[model samples]
Target: MKARIFVTLKGGVLDPQGRAIHHALEGLGFGGVNDVRAGKLIELDLADGTSDEDIDAMCRKLLANTVIENYRIEKAA
Candidate 1:
């Protein structure tokens, strides 16, 4: 089983790093750059029968900062 986690900043959070990245992209002549936010991706290969509840626990404990971001889990065969 494969688990893909997407961790992203919640709305209304200030992301200075993302802003800097956006500016750099603009300086490089990338057009149409509007807004930017940074996030994380975690891929886990686990044994079958791993529960969604357990995965949610993992995200809450270590994979994401609940104060600033939210996480979503995707399971793949």
Candidate 2:
């Protein structure tokens, strides 16, 4: 089975890297972008029958920093 995790900063958290990217985009003449948020995508290959609970645990334990970030799990085909 393949699992994909999306980790992103929580609201109210400062994101300097995202801000820099947004500025660079505006400098390149890419307008209409009001705000930008950056995140990470992690793809995992797991043995069959891995339960959702296990995946969730992975996110909570190490994949994401719960205090400052949130994560979503998706099962990939």
Candidate 3:
């Protein structure tokens, strides 16, 4: 089984890297970007019997930092 996890900054967190990219985009003449957020993608290959509960635990333990970000998990073919 394949599990894909996406971790992103929470709404109130300040993302300096994202802001820099946003600024660069503006300099390049792109407009209408209100904000930017940075994130991480984690892919896991697990045994077929891995349960949803286990995956959620993995995210909570290592895949995401709950103090700064939120995570979403997807099961893939």
Candidate 4:
């Protein structure tokens, strides 16, 4: 099985990397960009019998920092 995890900072959290990217975009003359946010995409290869519960546990325990980040999981067909 293959799974993908998207991890992003929660609203109201400070994102220095995102800010830097936004500034760089403006410097490059790309206009009208109001804001920028950065995130992570994690792909995982699991055994065929891996359960959803285990995958959720993986996110909660290590893949994401639940306090300041949110994660969504998508299983590949």
Q: Work out the TM-score per prediction.
A: 0.93, 0.97, 0.93, 0.97
Q: 15-52 in candidate 1: lDDT tens per residue?
A: 89899999999999998989999888999998899999
RMSD of each: 0.9, 0.6, 0.9, 0.6
Residue-level lDDT of model 4, residues 1-77, one tens digit each, is 89999999999999999999999999999999999999999999999989999999999999999999999999996
Candidate 4 has a TM-score of: 0.97
- Maximum-TM-score candidate: 2
**Candidate 3 lDDT, 1-77, residue by residue in tens:** 89999999999999998999999999999999998888999999999999999999999998899999999998997
Candidate 3 residue pairs in backbone clash: none
State the TM-score for model 1. 0.93
- Over the stretch 1-77, how does candidate 2's per-residue lDDT look in tens digits? 99999999999999998999999999999999999999999999999999999999999999999999999999986
- lDDT (0-100) at residue 41 of candidate 3? 93
| Candidate 1 stretches greater than 4 Å from native | none
lDDT of 1 at 52: 90
Predicted structure 2, TM vs. truth: 0.97
- lDDT (C-alpha, whole model) for all candidates: 0.94, 0.97, 0.93, 0.98
Q: For every model in order, what is the number of clashing pairs?
A: 0, 0, 0, 0
